[model samples]
Target chain A: MAYSDKVLDHYNNPRNVGSFDKSDPRVGTGMVGAPECGDVMKLQVKVNQETGIIEDAKFKTFGCGSAIASSSLATEWLRGKTVDQALEIKNTDIVNELSLPPVKIHCSVLAEDAIKAAITDYKKKQGVLTPEAVAVH
Target chain B: MPPLPRDYYGFFGFDRKLAIDSAALQKRFYELSRQWHPDRFGRKSAEEQEMALEATSILNDGYRTLKDPVKRAEYLLTQDGFPIAEQRGKDVPPELLEEVFELNMMLEEVKSGDESARPQLEQSRQHFLGLREGVDRELLREFQRHDESVEASPTSKQALQEIRGLLNRRRYIENLIRDVERALNPVTPSRPAPG
Candidate 1:
């Protein structure tokens, strides 16, 4: 399917396409693999520990155009936001923002999941378990 | 772990088979894809492009499941009135459980030993190779028996389940063997923790 103009723009010139200091206490990094496509994406967010605001977000993705667009849009949505606000940015929001087709909707969902995984990994490493992370499933 | 579509059967377009030619399956996938992929829709209307993408997606999912023998066996079990999941804590085949534990013990011993891990991994790999060959022989026998109606079958379903259980164990052993091989290879990543 022909991608939307927005999707094509992001694919052509992706933003924040790199990595950050994942080992830092205030930086959450998520590395996700799609076994279906053999694609791996790493996304990271640097948060202000005191104020819990994301100061920077970056990504390194190896996949098709939709995957790149999803990662770029996710990073754009995350910058300068509080952790709680970032958590609220759902897959549907990214999909709608990019106007992704149904076939590409999963790319958005995976990007959203990568964000949550990064945050959770940071919190786990820092040994500060938030209620969100520790709630009984 | 997501729910596979109820129409998964529609992808293969036939009742499942225990033994299939992997090459033939791949060839068929390529043929179906050539006929259905969205790239062919450049000259078609917009709606037609969408239809082509959806069809290709289904074809991809089907080929993925069938191309791997382990997954194909799991799909067969699901067809034969089994829950898709094995009970996590339940004991697998006793022989497999024993084999894994023994190999693991040997690996742990080899890890800090003076001798290189390469020799030990090679040794363990040879052992598992024998086990895989034996399992393959058994699986072939089971497949033949199922195919033959001449034998008065008293326990066909039971036999399939046993064969499925054996296949699951063989795959598990193969996975462990792969891990050991990776560890022995020169491409081993730095240890996760350093002093």
Candidate 2:
């Protein structure tokens, strides 16, 4: 299938395709997998300890072009954004940006999930209560 | 020929379970194949010939899916309205995430031509293979459990759901194994740049 120009561009030149030190208390790493397709994605966010801003983001994905593109776009959107703002990023936005076909929509979902998992990890390390935890009260 | 059953097990006249008798399935497949073989319908009416072709197609698809345990589980799961292949839900076991993370790192190293990573990749491959076998055994037991439960009962659904989760884990591990294989043996040789 012909990928959208944006998808192809991201696949060919994926931004921030690397990893950070997971042991660093400032860096939160999220690893997620789509069992259906056996696609694994790891997204990490380096947060500013005091300001709670995400200084940088990196991702590594093992799957199809759409998956690579989704996570690539995710990291680009993550950098310099606060963790709260990053959570606002949605799969639909990624899907629309990549112009992913119906079958490839799950790739965007995985990307969005990776972002949430990463942010959750970051929040957990700081011992700060997350909204979900706050919601339980 | 009457319309073949849509489900693979129904088409093959076998019970939907993980522990299928391979020999019996093979024998039944051959019998059905011969019965539906288009060549036997050479002198039949055009409509009869078309029916035979359709029946043969269904038979071929059923046999292919039913012969493999993994595919068979996936088929049963789809029939149960839990199509894992298309679902975006994160159903993997939480404990596996750590192992998957480390495995991915090793895979990256191997891809980068770090020969030192080969040993760890091999170890991971072996570990995942063992895990796959355990899943297969677990599936067999779960299949029997479901088959014994009253049809359409909550017990049956529970068993089916458990099988779906196992299959999801199996698929992820299978993918990791494939990546390890690819890294261990690089398929494409490096090509010289054009002058």
Q: Top model by TM-score, which number?
A: 2
- In terms of docking quality, model 1 is incorrect
By lDDT, the best candidate is: 2
Query: What lDDT tens digits, residue by residue, belong to model 2 across residues A17-109?
Result: 999998899998888888777778899999998887899999989889999999999999998899889888999999999999998998998
User: Which digits, one per residue and each the tens of the lDDT, describe model 1 over residues B1-195?
Assistant: 233244445565544566678787878888888987677898998878877777788788778887776676677667766543442212244345445544554565566663565576688888888888888788777765654533225556666666765666566667776756765663766576867
Output the number of the DockQ-best candidate. Answer: 2
TM-score of chain B of each: 0.71, 0.89
- Which 10 consecutive residues of model 2 chain B have the lowest summed lDDT? B86-95
| Pairs in clash, predicted candidate 2 | none
Off by over 4 Å in 1: A134-137, B1-68, B77-195
lDDT by residue (tens digit), candidate 2, B89-148:
467765686688688778878777788989988998899999999998998999898889
TM-score for predicted model 2 compared with the true structure: 0.84
Look at candidate 2 and tell me the lDDT of residue B147: 84
